[model samples]
Target chain A: MLEAIINILSWLLLLAGGAFGIIGGIGLLRFPDFYSRMHAAGLTETLCAICIIFGLVLQAGISLLTLKLLLILLFLLFTAPTATHAVARAAMIDEVEPVLSEDSPRLVDYEDRP
Target chain B: MRDTIFLIVLLALLWLAISGIYKPAILLLGLASLVLVTWVVIRMKIIGEEHNPTVFAWRLPRFWLWALREIVISNIHVARLVFRPEQISPRIVYQNVHFQRPLGKVIYGNTCTLTPGTVTVQLTKSGTVIHALDAKSADSLAELERRVHWLEGETDEVAAKDAGEERR
Candidate 1:
C-alpha cells in the first residue's frame, strides 16, 4: 500500500512539473517581448525543475538518488532567482521601457507629488 | 583556512547523503571533516553563527513559497502577451535598489534576469539596469525590487545582530 501511494505521488509530481515546464515554454515562445520571455524561463527553472526533482525522489525510493535530487533542487532554488534578477537589472539599466498595465500607478504623477 | 576544511566537509557530507551508504567509519570521517570545515569556514569568514544552517532552515522555505507564487502569476501574464504580440513594447529602464550587501545585490540582479521578458544588463551599488520586452516586465521588475528590498532588510537585521554579538 505504501509503495503504491509513493508511486501515485511520484506520478502526480511528475505531471505537475511537466505541465509547468510546458506552460513556461509556451509563454517563452508567445510572449511579445524579451522580458516576458525571461519571466517564463525563470518560471521553468524553479517551478518545473522543483516538481520534477521531487517526483524523481519519490520514484528513486529513498537512497543516494534522493540526496542528489535534493542537492539539485537546493542549487536550483538558490541560483535561478539570482540569474533572473541579473537579467532584469541589466535590461533596465539599458533603458528598456516596460509595457504598463492600464491600472499601473502613474509614475509621472507619483514623482511630481510633493 | 578553516573555511577550506568546512567546504570539504560539506562536500563529503553531501556525498554520503547522496550515496546513502552509512558505514560507521564513513560516518566518523564525515563528521570529522564537517568539524574541520566548520573551523576553517569560521576562520575564513565564509560561514558564521549568524548565517548558519539554523537561519537558512527557517528562511529558505519561506523564500520558495513566495518565489513560486510570483512565477505562476508572471508566467500566465507572459503567455497572454505572447499569444498577442501586439502587447510588446520593448524598452530599457532604470530602477533604484537599496540592498547593502553584495549577496543581496546578486540575488536581486539574478532574480530579475530569471523572470521572463526582462534581462539584467548592469548592476551597481546604487541600483540596477534592465531591458524589458515591454513596460509590464519593467514594472514587474520594479515591484520585485520592493520584495527583494524587504528580504534584504531582514538579512541586514540579522547581520546587524550578529555584528553586535561580535562587538560584545
Candidate 2:
C-alpha cells in the first residue's frame, strides 16, 4: 500500500516538473531581452530539474541511486548559479544594456544620485 | 596538510560511492588516482584557509537550507512573471555590501544569482550591481544581503546595537 502511494506521488511530481520545464522553454522565447530571458531560464530550469530529480529519488528509494540523484541535485545547485553569473558578467562586459522601461530609472543613474 | 588529507578522504569516498566495485585492481587504481589528484591540488597551492572545511563545517548545512527555501520562493515569483511578461520591469540596481571577506562576497553574489528574478552583474569593492526583473525583486536583495552577512558570522543584532551606540 505504501509502495502504491509512493508511486502515485512520484508520478505527480514528474508531471509537474515536466510542465514547469515546458513553461520555462516558452518563457525563454517570450522574454524581451537577454537578461530577462536568462532569469526565466535559470530560475525555472533549476526548480524543474530539482523537482524531476526528487521524483526520481523517490522511485529509487533508500539506495545508491537515490544518493547519486542527490549528488546530481547538489551539482546542479552549485554549477547552475555559477554558469548564470558567468553569462551575466560576460554580457555586462560586452556592453549589453538591459531593457529598462521609462518608468524605471537606470541603476547607474540611481547610484549616481547622493 | 589537513586540507590534503580532507581532500583525499573526500575523493576516495566519492569514488567508493560512484564506483561500487570492490575488485583489488580497481581499488588500487582509485587509490592511485586519489593520491595523484591530492598531489596536484597541493602543488597548485589552491587549498587555503578559505577552502578549509572547518571554516564552514557547522554553518554550511543551515545556510544551504535557508538558501534552498529562498530559491523555492523566488522560483515561484519568477515563474509567475514569466507567465505575464508584461509585468516585468527590468532594472539594474547597486547595493552597498560590507562583507569583510572575499568568500562572503562570493557567497552573497552567487546566492543572488541563484535566486530567481535577480542576477549579480558585477561585484565591486564598494557594492554589488544586480539586475532585477522588477522593483519587488530588487527590494528582496537587502534581506538576502543581511542573511549572507549573518552566515558569514556577522549577527544583525550586534550590528544594529553598534549603530545605535554610534547614534548616541
Candidate 3:
C-alpha cells in the first residue's frame, strides 16, 4: 500500500511539473518584452525543477542515486540564479529598455519574429 | 592559510561523498589532488579572507529555509501574472544593501534574482538595481533585504562603518 501511495504521489508531482513547464513556455511568447519574459521563465524554471526532481527522488528512495540527484538539484539551484543575474546584467549594459508601467511595453509580439 | 586548509577539507569531503570508495590508494590519490588544487588556487592570488565562506556555512540553513519559502510564494505570484499578463507592472528600481560585507551583497543579489518576480539587474558598490515584475514585488524587495540582513546577522552599513572606524 505504501509503495502504491508513493507511486501515485510521485506521478502526480511529475504531471504537475510538466504542466507548469508548459505554462512557462506559453508565458515566454506571451510576455511583451525582454525582461517580463524573464519572470515567466525564471518562475517556472525554479518551481518545475523542484517538482520534477523531488518526484524523482521519491521514486529513487534511499540510495546513492538519491544523493546524486540532490547534489545535482543543489548545483542547479546555485547556477540558475548566477546565470539569470548574468543575463539580466548583460541586458542592462546593452540598454534593453524594460517596460516601466502597466499598459504597454514594446508590443513587439513573438509572432513578428521569423 | 586557514581558508586554504578549509578549502582542502571541503574538497576532500566532497571527493569522498561523491566517490564513495573505501580504498587506501584512492584516498591517497584524492588527498594529492586536493593539495595540488589548493596550491594552484593560492598561487593564482584570488584567495582572500573574504573568500572564506566558512562563516556563511552556519548562516546558510536559515537563509535557505526562508528563501525556499519565498520561492514558493513568488512562483504562485508569477503563475498568476502569466495567466493575466496585464497585471504585471514591471519596473526597475534601486534597492539599498544593508549589510556591510561584500559577501552579503553577493548573497542578497543572488537571492533577489532567484525569486522570479524580482530580478537583480545590476549590483553596484552602493546598491542593486532590481527589475521587479510589479509594484508589489518592487516594494517586497525591502522585506527581502531585511531578511538578507537578518540571515547574515550583520548590521546596517552605517553601524558597520562606525565599528570599522572604532577598530582603526
Candidate 4:
C-alpha cells in the first residue's frame, strides 16, 4: 500500500511539473517583450525543475540518486536567477527597451538618484 | 586562508558525496583535482567570506524557508498570468537597498529574480533596478527587503548605521 502511495504521489508531482513547463513554453511565445519572457523561462528554471526533480527523488527512493537529484535542484535554484539577472542586465545596458503597459516612454535614469 | 580551507573542505565533501567509489586511487585523484581547483581560484582572488557570507549564519535556514514559500506562491501567481496574459501589467521600479556587503546586495537582487513575475534588471553602485510583471510583485518586494535586512543581522537601518556598517 505504501509503495503504491509513493508511486501515485510521484506521478502527480511529475504531471504537475510537466504542466508548468508547458505553460512556461506557451508564455515564452505569447509574452510581448523580452523581459516578460524571462519570467516565463524562470518558471521553468525554478518551479518546474524543482517539481520534476523532487518527483524523481520519490521514484528513486532513498539512495545516492536522490542526493544527486537534490544537489542538482539546489544548484539550479541558485544559478538560474543569477544567470537570468546577467542576461537582463546585459540587455538593459545595450538599450533594449521594454514595451511597458503604462505611459512611461523609456526607462528613467536611476544612476544619480539617492 | 580560511576561505581556501573552507573551499577545500566543501570540495572534499562534495567529491566524497558524489564520487560513490571507495578506492584509494580514485580518492587521490579527487584530492589532487580539488587542490588544483582551489589553487586556481586563489590565484583569481575571487573566493572569500563575501561569496560565502551566509554559509555560517544561523538565521539562513529560516530565511530560506521564507523565500521558498514566497517562490511557491509567486509561481502560482505567475502561472495564473500565463493563463490570462491580459493581467500582465509590467513596469520597472528603482529600489534603494541598504545592504553593506556585496553578498547581501547580490542575495537581495538574486532573490528578487528568483520569484516569478519579478526580475532584478540591474544592480549598480547606486542601487537596484527591478522589473515587476504586476503590482503585487512590486509590493511584495518590500517584504523581501525587510527579510534580507534581518538576514544581514541588522534589525533596522538605524541599528546598522549605528554600528558603522553602512556603506555603498
Task: Kindly list the per-residue Cα lDDT of model 2 for residues A35-99, writing each as its tens digit.
Answer: 99988887666878888998999999999999999999888887888889889888877878789
Off by over 4 Å in 1: A1-12, A26-37, A58-64, A79-114, B1-9, B22-57, B133-136, B153-168
lDDT of candidate 2 at residue A79, scale 0 to 100: 85
Best by lDDT: 4
lDDT of 4 by residue, B1-168 (tens): 877777788888889999999799999999899989888998998997754544638778878888888988998899899889888989888888788677788889989999998999878876888889888888899888888888887785534543685453
Angstrom error at residue B4, model 1: 5.4
lDDT of 1 by residue, B1-168 (tens): 443544565567576766566899878877787677666766777653324333345454655566667765665666566567676666655666676567667667666665555666566667655656667667777556656655654535534544798999
After superposing all C-alphas onto the true structure, candidate 3 shows an RMSD in angstroms of 8.1
Clashing pairs for predicted structure model 4, backbone only: none
Can you list the residue pairs that collide in candidate 2? Answer: none
Give the 10-residue window scoring lowest on summed lDDT in candidate 4 chain A.
Answer: A103-112
| TM-score-best of 1 and 3 | 3
What's the best-to-worst order under lDDT?
4, 2, 3, 1
Candidate 4, residues A1-114, lDDT tens digits: the string is 999999999999999999999998999988989999999998888789988998999999999999999999989998999899999988887989997877333465568433
For TM-score, the strongest prediction is 4
Taking the tens digit of each residue's C-alpha lDDT, what string does model 3 give over B1-168?
A: 887766777777778888898799998998889888888988998665554666766666867877888887888888888899988888766555657677788888888888888887777777777788888777778777876776576645534554798999
lDDT (Cα, tens digit) per residue for candidate 2, span B1-168: 776667777788889998988999999999899888888988888875554667766667877887878877888888888889999999878788888688888889888998878898888777888889898888888888877777777675535755798999
